[model samples]
Target: MGGYDGLVVLVGVALLLTTGRCDTSCGGTDGSPGVAGTPGRDGRAGMKGEKGEPAVKAEGPVDEVVLLTLKGEMGNRGLQGVMGPKGYRGDLGATGRPGQPGRPGPDGKNIGHGQQSAQQGHSAFSAIRTDNSLPRYEQRVTYQTIVVNKPGDFDKNTGYFTCRVPGVYYFSFHSMSKVSMCLRIASDALNEKLGFCDYNRNNDQVLSGGVVLQLTARQKVWLESFRDQQPSTDQRDTRDKYIIFNGFLLFSNDPELHFSLCGTGRGGFYFPVCSVRLPIMLHHFVLVIGALLSFAVPVKVAMESCPAAAMPGIPGMPGLPGRDGRDGEKGQKGDPGAAWAGGLGPQKGEKGEPGLMGFPGKRGQSGEPGRSGEPGLSGPPGEAGEPGTVGTQDRAAFSVARGTNEYPEKASVIRFTKVITNINNDYNTETGRFRCRVPGTYYFVFHASLEDRLCVVLKLDQTLLTSFCDHRRGRRQVTSGGLAVHLSQDQEVWLETKDYIGMRGKPTGFSIFSGFLLHPH
Candidate 1:
């Protein structure tokens, strides 16, 4: 069919074919596009399609969010997004720059002050500040000082004052005769009477003596006066006239209207200042001068300057005695006595044994003529004698008889009690004891002496010893004719030095050489 010629035919065929699409094509098919089946009527349109979730939108560096309301109809839900992977960390920020600096503040200048000025010599802390018109306050002594005297009255014009440190005090007081001046000091926080300077000089003189007082820091002290006797003069006027103290000075730093409740009666300065100020180093000089002056009071003790003395020479009498003439030479010693010079005698033993007759003494130079004997020739030497035997000793042995043969028996000196008789020695004091063999009175003498402090004291037990310094040197002394000592039986007499003494020769011994029993009474 070429275009127009088949057009109608094709159209017819298409319609027929379309009409027959539901019919089965072959044998036994369950479902197919065959003409046998017819189309069911269109079911109600399927429910409208579910809507999707709107996409989230984002802008630049910052994030944006939106909110939406849900519709009343049901819808299919969208899937959730997966979580993102972790991101890398960012770097730390840089440190900041430092800030700037700031500006500076006033000048200080010193004004006027004092108390530290005279620390070198001839100086001490002045009582008043340098600004004479002003008083001291709030300030204290920068250095330590000594107070010469207390500056307080009996709490009259001054505030109560306390001592600050302990030291010696020098004080002065002046008053007339028959009046009493008393000084009062407070310690342990109470006023106490310290000392009294009673002026009892009806002769218009002053009496002064020292009293020591001890004080400590912040201790209160005061001075006062009293009239002891009933004087004809007014006591109050006399108290005002007195000024008797000078020891040490204590002070307070800052001065105000306040003062030690003190007064000096009705007077000039409570404690006047001597105008001269000295360097502190010169303080020793002041002390020396003050000490000198203090010691020089009462006229008798005044110092007298004088020249020095020469050294002393050896002590001796001024002139020498006449010299003695020299003597002749001494003779030589004589030979020993010849053996058996005299008639032979019997041998002797010790005192216990019968003593042998003493060998006959050398022959006396007598005039007796001897009968002549026949002349003989010389004889040969005799045989050597045998050694003599040793002798035994005895206890309580008596000494050989003593003989004073130096001088004639009549010329030898003798003592009854001591070696020196009172006639020969002065100051020789001696005591004697005697046993009465004949019961008769005896004549006795004393020999006592003190050879330049070598004193001799004599005493006897069972007897009254009487002695005194006769002061007569070198003599035999007898008991005073007026008083005498009588003794009987046995008595022990001894001598001793009255003081620490040395001896000259022997000071004591006794001998009866011619001490005769007599009727001395």
Candidate 2:
């Protein structure tokens, strides 16, 4: 058949097959439908056609069949069309609000209170009692009674107060005696008397002494009658004050509160803020505030506002003049002047007769020795002298020999008591050790004579430098070992036996440990 007739026949057969399979009327229930396929991607847009030639003016109406026939099959996909013009940039996104602030962290630990309580219990105490009891001179005066003991720092039995803290402390002592007496305040910590009070009258009198000092922990202070003072026999009521000794801590040496509250030039007191009691600080603070307020107001205005000042009063008689002060000490005598020479204007008279010799004046005491003067500047070094005959170099050298030929115990260090030659005294005969005075290379030798097995070791400081062992038993066995070692200054070396070694009863000086410095580094 012709090509066109064959195609037409196939088309007719396909139509008939499709028509026969289609069922218009409903019959049995339909089977479940298969899942729909995914939609296909849309085809890319076609390239724009050239501007149409001026629209043709057509008198007849356009025909749809002609337009449909004009459409052509799609050509091979053209190169990807140019990307569409970029779209207008969108408005910038609104900035996000700042995140909320994080919650505050927990508070730090409290340090002020802990520092303030470090020296909370520091205090001083003292008292005096009178009941016909007298203490011997040069002895500690016990009050036998206490009036105030804030911290119990003083011991009534010992009549002494041991400082409990390292800080400044104030001590005071008072005594009442019927007869003339002297009292002394002494401190073992200072190894001397701090102060003394003396009453020179036979009638009853009071003597007191006080001292402020920086004391260290465990330091002791006390009051005692002066040596050789007469004992008092006067009887007095118990209520009468006689003797007392007391001291108290001013402040501690806590570093946390170290600061000067006032200037030392004005006799100011200084204390650690942490060591001061709260009550004392508050009291001081109140005083400071009151002082500031008082200074801020006008004194004259306040005085005028007072009722007493507003009412005038009659003037009183003047007070008598004060007595004149005692005379000052006499001045020292001046040395005699040399005789003047006669002037040329007039001739001098004959010299007077020699005056009678006055009794020899008492020999004046020798003057105290003068203090040593500072050292003078060093003189320039002298020129080198001519060279002399060359001699052996004086290298540090030492040799030791056994004093007694006796067997050494097992595991004991062998001591060389007899030093044959110690040029530099580097070897200690008592310790049997050689200490290196100069850093250098050294040669050490150990010679041992034994009849039985023995092991010897040479140790430098704590390390073994060399060792020797001999197991043979001979009538006269000799074992020798040596080592060349580098030693640092102050390093020590010695020889020790690992096992028992036999020795001749006679002093042969065969066994020896010796070392010599080869060259200083």
Candidate 3:
């Protein structure tokens, strides 16, 4: 069967080749195609054949120009090619235009519904004591120097600041004294103390204190000495200012309210709008009564209108509306209308009671969120806070000197009795020793006038810390020594003479002893 099929294919190819050659050589015309033929039955399926060999290459005529062309079926797509190498980075693009403005935020709720009614009040005063004479015990300290007295509330002669406006006020005082003094800031109206300062020394020292007070109208504030203590005068410079007192209002609690007229008229005054809506008979009666009272009682007209120099006040609030009138009697019903139009209407009935509330409807689907709004403007800054109180720690210091020159006293402590500056009272005038209250490092120094051989030793709790000596023959000489030592609480430190002593003190020699805390533990 294979041989027979191969023979038929070879014969068909040979006949097609011969016919094409003959037609080209003899130039014969094409014959008509035959159509009438009986149909044949379908043949059986054949076995699958092996792969065929590729066709050999054939060379055509060099210059054979073919005019007619036939369309061919499209071939299957080829496999994808290899990927290309990575490309170089591209140049940056130009910047885009600015975006549109953002949506505006919602309006804020109003705080106060009307215009402001009052302004900030201001009242401040500062005075200094000028008289050097001592006052009687518990007397008020008077001031001859008036630095500033805004609103003229402070009376210099009486040394008292009388309150005219009710508000919070701050008061402070500074005094320089050479004697033990107790000064206090007191309210005269209440006869109560507000603040005080205790300064005890025999030399010049400054003491200061301050306090804040909430005061009412008619209250008075002044400075007074306690236990007959006197703030001594500054002997060196009489012109130097001392004993200064200051007071100022921080804020007010009351707002001023007054009536104002709207038109320029001599007899016009402020009155509510509802008062002018009276009936004709009532108006006549009020006019007669006003005329009768005109002669006996004076009618002070506190009228205000457009001013030439100052801004006007805000107008008063409006009055309430009048009441409704009574209803009239009902009328008869009307006749019916034509058929093409609407029929007769029903009469209006009285209002009925409200029905029960219905169930809530279903929630709707959520919408896309809106864009964010722009930021709001910043608010004004807040007010400053009040002054802080004074600290009491880390304030240990002293300065003492001897008043009388004394002779030798072996194995004994040299006591300097006169006090100049004993801030925390760490030094003892009777014991001639310094007791530590706060544990810390301290610096101590002393200067002694010697007429003959003298030796002084600094001791800490019976342990020698340092010493100094001076020798001269019947002639005055000076000796000084100092040291920085660490001390603990309850430790005792003092200066003592050993073997020989010639310590001169006070007015003639001016010997002194001083010490101060350097750092706290």
Candidate 4:
């Protein structure tokens, strides 16, 4: 093998060293010499050569320089081979650091001014009869006049003050009459009279009553005299301020009570000054005195019992123990106490028989359900059942599309012409009705493309189940509604449009109605 390899290497080197000379072929213009050369016979073939021995493997690694030289002397590139399989994905990169915070924006406009305006609108009004010169004397007189109307809540023409804000208010009315009469203040909104005042005298006397009432917005109040009693028609226009009606807001019904300086100090105090308007009754006086005593008594007792500072006394030494006292004789027992001396003592009675058991009480209502528990571990699957015969397909499903894109003129059933999937043939394409073939729970959905305004309702028989409505301003809009219903066999369901006008038809098949049986009963 070694000798053969060496011979082959020498032959390769000789071939590389030798250079071939160029040869030129002459054209045979003349016929004589060209014809003689053409008759030469073909050369004989050489014998077959024996197979060469296999090359021996190298013992050690090749030198770096020789390996590089061999790599540089590579032959012409071969055709590209088929692509290799994709490699596995690399690990995800680390997360980047957070960015710095941005600068704050400019200050916004103040919104408290609007809130203050809303609060200022919540005020009260007061009014009185301005015309006392009229000679007509009648009972049940609605004071149709105004003397002091604040915030303009009270109407002089209607004799009613409509509450603009819900809050607690104080109302007062005073009237003078020459004869006995009953003055009443009432509220039609409350459907009851609030307060009453009476003046029973031949001479002119004053009658006044006040009420602290909680009223809501739009509620009305008025002053009226009782129809059973007649009020004196004294025409004397004295400056007695006799007939007067007044009211003021106490506090609004806001969740958080807010007090303004004017509202808090109207009568010169941080607290509500009820004495300025509301008459203090005996109970109110007692409450005030009790509150004052409650504070003053504790302070007085604390001051009286306060210990005075004094110098500490010298430490005393321990004294010797005294002798024990002698034992005293026992006293005789007291006489037996009379029966029922302090109070009547009942005699012991005979034992009673056991009573029968009572019937059990009705069960209380069930409490709210508790949260669902975590799922348990799954069990092994059951064995497979025997193969059964293939059953016929009886799917109850339908998909319908409206024939026209135009909106219905009025509320009416929408008929469908295009049927996409109507298995079991349970849907009527002409009337757009679907009859339930299987008694089971099913899901139904309807979609409509609205251009202007449209309202569509999904109905089960004649009963409306669900509705969808939309009003588009510029372009057509699409709205859909769906419901899950437990339907019996032969139950009908359809879609009805309400007040749908100028609705563009869905040529792109956007509007659709579909239903399917979830599971047959």
Which lDDT values do the candidates have, in the order given? 0.29, 0.57, 0.61, 0.55
Off by over 4 Å in 4: 1-384, 387-394, 501-503
lDDT of 4 by residue, 384-484 (tens): 43222112133466655566766665777787676644655788986778898878787777655455667778899899998877664443334567798
The C-alpha local distance difference test score for the whole of candidate 3 amounts to 0.61
Residue-wise C-alpha lDDT for candidate 1, range 1-521, written one tens digit per residue: 37886898989999889656524332232332323334334444444444433322232121112122322333334343344344343343343333332222122211113212111101111121111111112112111122322333222223223443333222222233333332232234333332332333233333332222334445654334333332434343332222333333211122211223444222222433335667665334334343434454555564343223323444443344334434434434444322332333112222243334444444434344434444444444444433221111100000010122121122121122322112112111222223333333433322221122223334445333543333332321111111223434343333333432322212111011112223322
Candidate 1 vs candidate 2: which has greater lDDT? 2
Give the count of colliding residue pairs in each prediction: 73, 0, 0, 1
Error of 2 at 35 (Å): 29
Quality of model 1 by C-alpha lDDT: 0.29
Best by TM-score: 3
Q: Give, for candidate 2, the lowest lDDT window spanning 10 residues.
A: 385-394
Specify the highest-lDDT model's number: 3
User: Tens digits of per-residue lDDT for model 2 on 1-521?
Assistant: 69999999999999888666543321333344444445545545445544332212233333335444544444444445445444454454455445445455444322232322324446678767554555666787776788777667788888888876565565656666655445666785453453343323344555554544556667888887664333344222223337767676544444243336643222222443444445534333333333434346545633222221223334444445445444444444444322223322212334445444445444444445545445444544444432221112324556565667577667777787766446457888888888888788887765554556778788988798777887756434345677888988899988887755654322221455657655678
Candidate 1 segments whose C-alpha is farther than 4 A from its true place: 1-156, 159-161, 166-192, 197-202, 232-240, 249-521
- In the range 68-109, model 3's lDDT, one tens digit per residue, is 232233444544544444444444444444455545544432
Q: Quote model 4's TM-score.
A: 0.26
lDDT of 4: 0.55
